[model samples]
Target chain A: MSTFLLILITGIGLGALYFLVASGLSLIYGLMGVLNFAHGAFLTIGAFTGLWIATKVFPNPTTWTFIFSMFAGGIAAGLFALLMEQLVITRLYNRHIDQALVTVGVSLVVTALLGGWFGFDARFLPTPLWFTKAATIGDAIIPVDRFIYIGVAAILLIAMLSILKFTRIGLIIRAGVENRSMVTALGINVRLAFSTVFFIGGFAAGVGGVLISVFSYGVSPLMGGSWLIYGFIVVVVGGMGSIAGSAIAAMLIGITNQFANYYVTGLGDFVVVIILAAVLLTKPTGLLGKVSH
Target chain B: MLRWKYSRPLLIAITVIFAILPFAGDNPLSKAGLQQTMAVAFLFGALALTYDLLFGFTGLLSFGHALYFASGMYVTAILINDFNVNFLLAILIAVIFTSLLAVLTGGAALRTTGITFAMVTLAFGQAGHVVIARDFGGFTNGDDGLPVNADRLPDFFIGVVNTKYLYLLALGILVFIYFTAWWITESSAGRVFAALRDNEQRVSVLGLNPNRFKLLSFVLSAAMAALIGAAMLIVSGSGSPRYAAADITIALLLMVILGGPVTRWGAVLGGIIYSVLSTRLTVLSDGTAFDSLPNFIGGPLAEPAFTLGLIFILIVMFAPGGISGAYYRARFKYLNKGK
Candidate 1:
C-alpha cells in the first residue's frame, strides 16, 4: 500500500511536468493548426538560461534566487518564441506544413547550437537543499520535490483556466479555436492572437524546462526532446486545445507509466504506446477534442 | 515538358558516370575513404527517393518512416547473426515482415489527416525506437548496437579491399529503387496517387477509395525504405538504434525538401548532396580549419547540424521549390531570352 502511494505521488509529479508542456502545445495547436516542433527548443532554451542565471549570475543560489532564475528562464523563452513567431511563422502564414518544417529546422539549429556551446554533456542544476529531502506520509516516503511540482502545476492550471474563463484575450483565443474564419470575419486581429499563443506556450514550456531540470537533477541539450514527445502524447490523448483534458490525460499516462515500469521493468513505454494506439483508433479526436473540419 | 524531354538521357548519363566512378584512376573519388562516403550517399539517395514516393508524390507527410527502415536493418542483422540464415534470405524475410508492419501501422495512422496523422505516425515510430533501444527479448543487443556477423557473409562483401563491391552494390540498389519509383509514378496507379495528393474528395466522388490508394503508397514506400535499410546494413556492416530514431525520418524529409519534393531526381540529388556534405563537414570540423577563427563563430561552424539546419531554414523560407525548381526557373528564363 505504501509502495502504491509512493508510486502514485511520483506519477502525479511526472504528470505535472507533462501538463506544463502540453497546455501550451494544445492551445497553440488548437488556434494555429501547427504541431509546433520548435516547442522543445523553447524548453531547452529556458533550461539553459535558468542554469546560466543560477550558476553564473546568482552564484550559489538560495530558494528565492532559484525561483527568480526559473521565472527569468520563462521570460527568456517567451521572448524567443515571440521572435520566432514574427520572423518565421508569420511569413509562412497559412502554410501549415511549411511552418512545421521551419520549426523542425529551428529546433535542430537550437539543439545543435546548445550542444556546440555547452558540449553534449549533462550539466547539473543547483537546487535548494530542501528539494533533496523526503517527507513521510502514512508509511509512504515522498520526495519533497514532488510536492513542489504538483503545487506549481496545480497553480498554473488554475490560473490558465481562470484566464480562459474571464479574460478578453482568452475569449478571443477560444473563439479563434472554435471557428478561425468566423473570428477573423468578425474583425479581430487573429495574427496578434497567434503571437500571444506562441509566447504563452513558450513561457509555459520554459517553466516546464526548469521544473523538469529539477526533477531529473540535471540539464542536457537533448533533455527537451524526450519530454516533448511525452507532451505531444499528452496533448493528443487529452484532446488538442483542452487544458482540462490535458491534465487528465497526463495523469493517466504518468500513473500508467509508473505502475507498469514498477511491475514489468521496461514495459512502461510500450504500454503507453499501446494506450496511444488504442486512443487514436477508438477516439481519434481525443477525449475532449471537437471534430475538426 | 522540357524536363521530360531531357530526363531520360540525363538519367542514363548520370548512371554511367556513377557506374565507372570506382574505376576513376588516381583520383580521390576511387579511394577507400571517399568510396565508403559515396556508398552511404547512394544508400541515402535510395532512402530519400522512397520518402519522396510518400511525401512528394502521394502528398503524405509521414513522420515515422524510419520504423520500417529500422525493422529491415534489425531483422536482417538478427537473422544472419543469431539464426545463421543466409544474408539474402534474411533480407527477403525482413522485407516481407516490414511490409506487413507497415500495413498494420499505416492503416491505423491513415485514419487521421494532416497534423494528427503526423503525430500518430511519430508515436508509432517512437514506439519502435524504444523497443529496439530497450533490446526486447535481448534480440536487439540494446543501445550498444548489433554488428553484422562478417564470418557468415560472402567473399565479395567481406573487407576494406572489397569496399568497391559494396559501393557498386549501393549504387545498384539506388538504381533499382529509382527505376521502381519512376515506374510507379508514371503508371495509372501513380496518377491516382498524384490525384489523391491534389484532392482526396474528388477521388472519392469519382468512386475510388482514397484510403486504399494511400495505403498502397504507404506500404510501397515503406517496403522500398526497408530494402534500403537491408542494403545499408550490408554497406555499413552494423545496425544501430539510431536507424529507428526520428532523426533519420527528419533527415529524409530534409533531403526530399532540399531536392524538390514532387521531382523524383531531385530527391535523389538532395539525399546524395546532403549525405556527402554531412560526411565532409564532419571531416572539416575535425581538422584545424576552424581553429584559426575565434571561439564563438568557429565553435558553431564546427557543428554540421547548425550549418545544415540554417541552410534548411533558408531553403524552406526562400526557395520553397528547392534545387530542381531553381534550375527549371533559370532554364525557362534562358529559353525565353533565346526566343
Candidate 2:
C-alpha cells in the first residue's frame, strides 16, 4: 500500500513536470502551428543556463539563489526562442514539414553545442540549503523534493489556468489558437502573439528541466531529449493544442508510466507506444480535443 | 554541375564510384581509409536517400524513420549471432522483417496528417527504442549493441574487400532504391502525393482516397530505410539502436529539407554536404577551418541552430523552390533560350 502511494506521488510529481513542459508545447503547436522540435533543447539550454548562473553569477548559491538561476534559465530559453522565431521560425510559419525540419536543425545545433561545451557530462547544482531529506509519513518515505515538484507543478498549472481564464493576454492566446485566420483577419498583430507563444513555450521547457532534476539530480546536455519525447506524447495524445487535454493526458501518462515500470519490467515503452497508436487509430482527434484532421 | 541530372549515366557513375572508391587503396583494403570512408558514406547515402523517398516524394515528415532502420539492423545482427545465418540471407530476411514492421506502423500512422502524424510516428519509434534497450536484451545486447564480425559471412566470402564489398553492396541497394523512388515520383501515384501535398482536402473531395496512397508511400519509405539499416550493419559491422533512432532520422530530414525536398538530387547533394561539414566540424581542431567558421558566423550573430535554421528560414521565406528548384528553373530558362 505504501509502495503504491509512493508510486502515485512520484507519478504526479513527474507528471506535473511533464504538464509544465507540455502545456507550452500544446499551446505553441495549437496556436502557432510550429511543432517546435527544439522545445526540449530549450529545456537543456535552461539547465545549462541555470548551472552557469548557479556557479558563476550568484554571490551565494543558496536554494533561493538556485531558484533564481533556474528562473534565469527559463528567461534565457525564452530569449533564445524569440531569436529563433525572429530569424528562422518566422519564415516557415505555414509549412509544417519545413517548420519541423528547421527546428530539427535547431535541435541538432543546440544539442551539439551543449555536447561540445559540456562534453556529455552532467553537472548538478549543489544541494539546496534546505529540503534535502526524505520525510516519512505512515511508513511511506517521500523525498521532500518530490513534494516540492508536485507543489510547483500544481502552482504552475493553477497559475496557467488562471492566466488563460482571467488575463487579457491569455484570452488573446486562446482566441488565436481557435481562429488564427479570423484573429489576423481582424487586423490584429498575430506575429506578436507568435513571438509570445515561442517565449512561453521555451520558458516552460526550462522550468520543466529544473523540476525534473529532483529525480535525476544532474544536468546533462542530452537530458532534454527523453523528456521531449514524453512531453510530445502527452500533448499529442491529449489533442494537439488543447490545454485541458494536456493536463489530463499528463496525469494519465504519469500513472501509466509508473504502473508500467513497476509491473511490466521491459514493456513500459512498448505499452506507451501501443496506447498512443491505439489512440491515434481510434481517437484521431484525442479524447477531449476537437478532431481537426 | 554535370552531375546534376538523374540520368542513367549519372546512376552508373554513382555505382562505379561507390564500388571502386572503397577498394582504391593499398593491400588489406579492410584497413584502408578509403574503404572505411566509402562504407560510411554509402550507408549514409542510402539512409539519406531513403529519407528523401519519404520526405521528398511522399510529403510525409517523419521524425521516427530511424526506428525501421534500427529494426532491420537489429534483426540482421541477431540472426547472424544466434542462428549463424549467412550475411546475405540475414540481410534479405532483415529487409522483409523491417518492411512488415513498417507496414504495421504505417497502417496507423497514415491515419493522421501533418504534425500529429509526426508525433505518433515519433512516439512509436521511442517505444521501439525502449524495447530494444530492455526487452531484447539477449538479441540486441541492450544499449551496448551487438558486435558483428566476419563470422557472420561465409568462409569463401573472405577477401581484402570486406568493407569495400560492403560499400559496393550498399551502393547497389542505394541505386536501386533511388531509381525506384524516382520512378515512383514520376509515376501517377507520385502525382497523387504531390496533389495531396498541395491540398489534401481537395484530393479527398476529388474521390482519390489519399489514405491508401499515404500508406503506400509510408511502406515504401520504411522498406527503403530498412535497406539502409541493413547496409549500415554490413559496413559499420555492428548495430547501435541510436543509429536507427530519432537522431539520425532528424539529421537526414535536415539535409533533405535544406537541400530541396521535391528535387530528385537535392537530398543527395544536401546529404553529402551536410555530412562533410559535420565531420569536418567535430573532427577538426578549434583552430581549423570549420571549427572557427560556423561559430564565427553563427555565434557572432546569435545561437548556432540560428545559422543553419536561418538557411532554411531563407529558403522557406525567399526561395521556397530550394537549390534544385533553382537548378530546374535555370535549366528551363536555358531550354527556353534555345527554343
lDDT of 2 by residue, B250-272 (tens): 77876776677777667776766
The positional error of residue A290 in candidate 2, measured at the CA in angstroms, is 4.2
lDDT of 1 by residue, B1-339 (tens): 436577789889988887787787877768888889999999998999999999999999898999999999999999999999999999999999999999999999999887778778988998999899998889998898989999998989989988989999999999999999999999999999999999999999999999999999999999999999999999999999999998999999999989988889889999999999999988998998899888777777888889889999999999997898788878788768857
Where model 1 places Cα greater than 4 Å from the true spot, the runs are A291-293, B337-339
Candidates in order, TM-scores: namely 0.98, 0.90
Q: In model 1, what are the clashing residue pairs, if there are any?
A: none
- lDDT for each of the candidates? 0.90, 0.75
Candidate 1 local lDDT, A130-222, one digit each (tens) = 888999999999899999889888988998888777988889988888899999999999998888888888988898899899998888988
Candidate 1 lDDT (Cα, 0 to 1): 0.90
**What TM value does model 1 have?**
0.98
Q: Which candidate is the best by DockQ?
A: 1
Candidate 1, residue A74: the lDDT equals: 86
Task: Report the lDDT tens digits of candidate 2 across residue range A134-221.
Answer: 8887999877777777777777678777877897777778888888888888888888878888898888788777666645778887
Number of colliding residue pairs in each model: 0, 1
- List runs of model 2 lying over 4 Å from the truth: A264-266, A290-293, B1-11, B21-31, B155-161, B199-207, B285-322, B333-339
Model 2 residue B72 CA deviation in Å: 1.6
> Candidate 1, after superposition: displacement of residue A67 in Å?
0.8
Model 1 chain A weakest 10-residue run by lDDT: A284-293
